[model samples]
Target: MAGNDVEAEKPAHSLFDNLQGLAFGVIMVSFGISLLKAQGLITGQAAGVAFLISYSGGIEFGLVFFVVNLPFYVLAALRIGWGFTLRSLACVASISVLTSLAPRLFSYAHVEPFSGAVVAGLCVGIGSIGLFRHGASGGGVGILAYYIQQRTGFRAGWLQLLLDAVIFTAAAFVLPGWGVLVSMVGALALNLLVAVNHRGDWYIAR
Candidate 1:
């Protein structure tokens, strides 16, 4: 490629933006774990899979979760382009690192089922909205959601709901009923948060 062409194609992202996203990812993972432990609720997709492995195999949930998600990062890069992918990788890595390390750093883990669901929903909803605001994503459902958006221009949030349904359904069969129900409540909260917060036309950059 020509030098000028390559230079023009480069993606730009500020350090402040990256750090902000990293902070969001960390808090989300930390709270997510708290919610799960509190309600005995499982998460979706790779997280749900990780919960199963950790619950059954006596492995660290973060370790299992990271390993399961590792294989998909490359595909995420290819589809979403490098800058967004890198930011997402940072978010994913932060989530993994914190999930593994947070328990050692903090003491609270117990939570009531209803409260756990509320916190999990809020954490994911707010975190995801922040990521979207910065023109990046954590690259799980976001990756699939983008593809569907490109093809259909439909609401990616709805796509996520459908996808989460499938994952949570499988989780229900594997996990206890109350846990599954809590996850459902968490899902509802996450979708509502995204819908309410992500109106691009309404947002003004600070």
Candidate 2:
């Protein structure tokens, strides 16, 4: 009877968690897109390059997002287990599709740059935690960071910082120089929140 109760509860709990992840993922993607529209900031990643291309060429950001992530899905499968990779892929799909559609429905104009940066970072960070709890992520630099952590001992956060540095450095030419700094600050906030909160031994989630 106890085992039966546990089994029944498990699926319910999983459904709840997935719904929560989906909700947060929507907010995170929306926040990111809003930041881009408001700040003209390019995030440091393949996504950043995609944003730059989209901004300059008038391409849809979501299509650019999906294209940029295609190659990394293979790397994710090779490094992480298939299940983790698939879940991450799902997250990427949700984010990309919603990112594309949400902007069409909503206006993100008139947000102050500094306020938007901080709020956007917090939204992305909290949303990332929600996705990570469900075995998923936003899946850009995070994918590369995961692969690096698998092959080398460097922490995923550190690798992410390095990658962001290079990517944002290149971004100087693509955006106003100061926008690069704001984007870097946003990345720092997001990455810091992830590094601090996501410890394997801290939470006994089953």
Candidate 3:
């Protein structure tokens, strides 16, 4: 490996930097999720599950997402450590707050579903890179997936794909067929960005 790469892997981000990363990343994700929700679309993993529950019960997305993540914190604390667990909690809390406030804070004058999907994917995907680099996660399936991957070399990609399939299948029943299909496009975009950028061998100033 290059010296720069090795160095990049070693330096830790400052507290301010991590806080900035968590704040910005969570905001981006919250915006993306808000757009998806407005369109009756769903992504993958825990967020997707939260969306399903929220839609079915007419509950706020923030509340549903927060409640759904309760169990995952145990896994995060046990597997990742207190620092990671705390940071992840902060990220999730930011998401819950930002998502709850986004709709009220801004109005979407023109929201094309397909465009919303693309935007959501790009924003969340790119933002997630920042969050992960700062040693924080958006909680839910991400924490569980990492914990499982640590125990077994089963790869997070496969696990995410399976979860996406399950989420989409569930969406097919509750959401419009078109909404479910379009949601897949956004999910693909998001995952593709993550796959391309979030490499362990890449820059890792965590």
Best by TM-score: 3
Residue 136 in candidate 1, Cα distance off native in Å: 3.2
CA deviation > 4 Å runs, candidate 1: 1-13, 150-152, 204-206
Clashes of 1: 0
Whole-model lDDT, model 2 = 0.70
Put down candidate 2 lDDT per residue, 33-126, tens digits, no spaces. 6666556776655667777788778998878877888888887777777876877777777777877776667776587776677677767767
Q: Which lDDT value does model 2 have at 8?
A: 53
Score candidate 3 by lDDT. Answer: 0.81
Q: How well is each residue in 94-206 modelled by candidate 1, as lDDT tens digits?
A: 77777777667766556667777778777867777677667555546665665555457666667777777888767766778877887888877776666666664455452
What's the residue-level lDDT of 49 in candidate 1? 68
The TM-score obtained by model 3 is 0.90
Steric clash pairs (candidate 2): none
* TM-score for candidate 2, residues paired by index: 0.81
My TM-score estimates for the predictions, one after another, are 0.80, 0.81, 0.90
